[model samples]
Target: MSDKGLHKTNQNGVSRRGFLGRTGSILGAMALAGQIAPSQAQAATAGAAAAGPIDNGAHVPALVIGTGYGGSVAALRLAQAGVDVHMIEMGMAWDTPGSDGKIFCNTTTPDYRAYWLRTKTKAPLSNFLGFPIDKAVPRYTGILDAEEMGGIIVYQGRGVGGGSLVNGGMAVTPKRANFGAVLPTVNADEMYDTYYPRANAGLGVSLIDPAWFESVDCYQFSRVGRKHAQRAGFPFVFVPDVYDWDYMKQEAAGTVPKSAVAGEILYGNNAGKKSLQQTYIAQAKATGKVTISPLHKVTSVSPASGGGYTVVIDQINTTGDTVGTKTVVADKVFFAAGSVGTSKLLVRLKATGALPNLNNEIGKGWGDNGNVMCGRANHMWDATGKVQASIPCGGIDNWDAGGAFAEVAPLPTGIETYASFYLSITKNPNRAEFSYNASTGGVELNWQTAWKAPSIAMAKTIFDKINSKEGTIYRTDLFGTNKIWGDHLTYHPLGGAVLDKATDNYGRLHGYTGLYVIDGALIPGNTSVNPFVTITALAERNIEKIIATDM
Candidate 1:
């Protein structure tokens, strides 16, 4: 078979000794370090499950909405401080395996299990050679949710892990200088020295073993990406990830079930990736002071006449039906439902008189993190390898001059497509505002599809350079035939209820004593990298202060 076809098939000549030699030692070390065992993890979850549902006007001391990085951190820290915390999630629990014995559907074969409430799949790379590449899928509550707004498609994860369930696992911390600029009011010294490190450790962020990366078949695409970037006079940096290196090595060696190598990210990683569900959420459950209610979507948050918040939630079923409406009275409420989710809820509440005192900055200062995805048509000699891994390990950092950090993303089509794709986080200063629509009883984001022009222009500063150096041209087939950039969507939506403006410096809402705005909503606009690590560190910093004083 050709090399392209060879890579499509499973690696041959695997042996038990070879597998154990590479992975066993690493697993042993991890186990020796008192990592939570499977049974212990299950026991912790059972303890949290033992807490009964908070339906029918049940009251709790603290209620966290959404289970993303911010909510997970808040829940864990609050629980660890001996506070009873309850989390409400709109997504389903992803721990249980389906009838196919998998927690998520692979990217190579998307089905009803790949999307959330969509009849048709909406992949980031939507087409090839003028032909639509996405297929029809059943309308079900899947993992990745492509929520449509007025002018942009927001991609978010839906499950216990939230964005962690569907993201690329690229746990990137912004440069200290850039981070300080992003959030000027935040104490840079405290964030860089304390919270960033703390968040990295809590999230299990680690660099790829350089030696292993050099030899791994799955990383050949990244190496090619590095080569082109360096040749074009750009710096290629190794980006840290939340994936376990030992497990990835085992997957490449064909000694274990594959996740990253088997095209697992974007939907979910069935193994190896250390999502928030496995870390903070699990630890919170172990405290036995935190209980999570999945499939519970918080609709409104209004002040109760009794000096607390009244939260109305809809219990959704597997088929996306709102089966029941429930109420919870909480002393505190945290808006951690991500940038879009939180912004939508807040804008509606402010306009509908539920939270009339909310500041005018409720849904202002929103941005797409300057997200732009593009692809380059490389020569046949620049083969990006057929064995491309889904979890990206490196990126081209032209942020200093070009205002863009471009990840050498994988085109894990299970075949050699002879294309190089990149997802760039640029420094686009364009901001959108979410306004309440009185007619539709919904929120509208006043961001035109054309607003992505600046982001696309910023990204071209890097790709255009490389393309010129390599004598290559942009690929129109990847995103859509004749379409050079996928700029109508954002995977990293930041801002809306920004820190210090919409809330206090510590994430507390201006008018509400007990309400907080955590998650990506606190970011002013852009993080210049993947927003999760920054979101996490900011949460760590804010929650630490909140626990010490507010609680």
Candidate 2:
């Protein structure tokens, strides 16, 4: 559908075109606050339009903060249940193409669309061959956000689709046995039998073809990884993803536009990957009762004098400046801003007395999901081919015995690195807490760097044995000189307003009647796998009950 068709009036008679004159920038205010090269600015200027806007002071039946997994699910279900919903996102809509004729830049090429409002890029792989690889870029409202909080860096997606736009599309579900630890309060059978399948179907999850997997040249790195794991007496499993496998096959055959094959995972994928924008968000838009306002940040939500709640929003430009402030009323508010965003907002609200009645367990249980990265110098005979696919299709499962499940991640450096990369999701027990700092008027997460020791130890249970078997050593040049483990950052940030502790079993905040926590903030610590699938399933389960009862 064209961008103009996305701005139709909803049931509440809110015409989005009325608010277009308020700002000159259409949709997301392209080109780094209108300071980019003329040619680049021209391309972004000729791109698509924004979502149906929710005008200032317009009342909404439901207001959802952040358009990640939980928010998307909530908006869709609520709209289906006869409620007009409006979603507020802090980042851009990401529906426009740049000078490169692509909505997103490649992983290897860091452009203005890479980092979020930063003058310099903060790539996860900071160093290569003992040299720093960070570069300067124009500060803008990009998609990926590398948030530095105290001792750890949490990488989150910043646009309307949230983490789905930047993630590797690994839709992994935890084992049935490990389900007990993931959400001990929720029923295991209902989740596995009903919600899990529903979430998977809703996400369009599918496995890679085994026949093509063994023959494809793009997946040569995964083949090498599988051989190494099998030789080391570890089980090698094919983890399903949300990437369009047929489209990937077409890319391998030179029959379509390349995305995953062109090393486009870190920033965003232009094609072949099924992000939330392509799935739930699209479905919600099709419902005609859901509208979204991009570049609008929800700063405050408190009880109103009449009833419901009052929400304060800041409309920002591309350079992160608040251009206008608007206050609206919402019958109900759902906090769906990923783990960090939701936790930080709630912590500040509680401390600043905007939400005085919030329970003491608001910011208690936060964790990094035991995310750790490492690389092994494979022998020259086992060359992980120069042509590699960015979407990972396999992993090493050691969770039952060693408390770790390692994904054989892609290097996609566009060259033969001769190194085996692995990102392990271990069973680390260290949990952090977010506290409000009165001096800075900001939230601080008390997660120490030393807390990653248990994660590193658990990850070694897989790499150490494989290294001992293959007679290979750890690669010291990838992360930094003499630094073997990438323990400073976490791609999977889970928890804060933990289930049953901060909220009820169904994610309703304890003290607030019309408020809810429906995102990864409800999951405690770890999900034993890539947590998006579990996050979606839990949202499906909770929102189903919520719509059936609350609405």
Best model number under lDDT? 2
| Colliding residue pairs in candidate 2 | none
* Candidate 2 structure quality by residue, lDDT tens digits, 1-551: 01121111112211111010000000000121122321546434422226655688988999999999999999999999999999999888887777767777767777877778898878777777677777777877878888998889898998888988877777787787788998999999898778887788787777788999999888988999999999998988888777778788888888877777776678787887777887788889999999988888999999999999999999887778888899999999999999999999999999999898889999988999999988889999999987778888878988878889888988877888898888889999999999999999999999998999999999999999999999999988767689999898888999999999999999999888999999999999898888898899899999999999998
TM-score per model over all chains: 0.91, 0.92
How far residue 58's Cα lies from its native spot in candidate 1, in Å, is 0.9
Expressed as tens digits, the lDDT of each residue in 206-261 for candidate 1 is 77888988978888888889899999988888887777777888899898888778
Best by TM-score: 2
What is the lDDT of every predicted structure here? 0.79, 0.82
Model 2 regions lying over 4 Å from their true place? 1-49
Q: How close is candidate 1 to the true structure, as a TM-score?
A: 0.91
The per-residue C-alpha lDDT of model 1 at residue 157 equals 87
Q: How badly does each model clash, as a count of residue pairs? A: 0, 0
Candidate 1: residue pairs that collide:
none
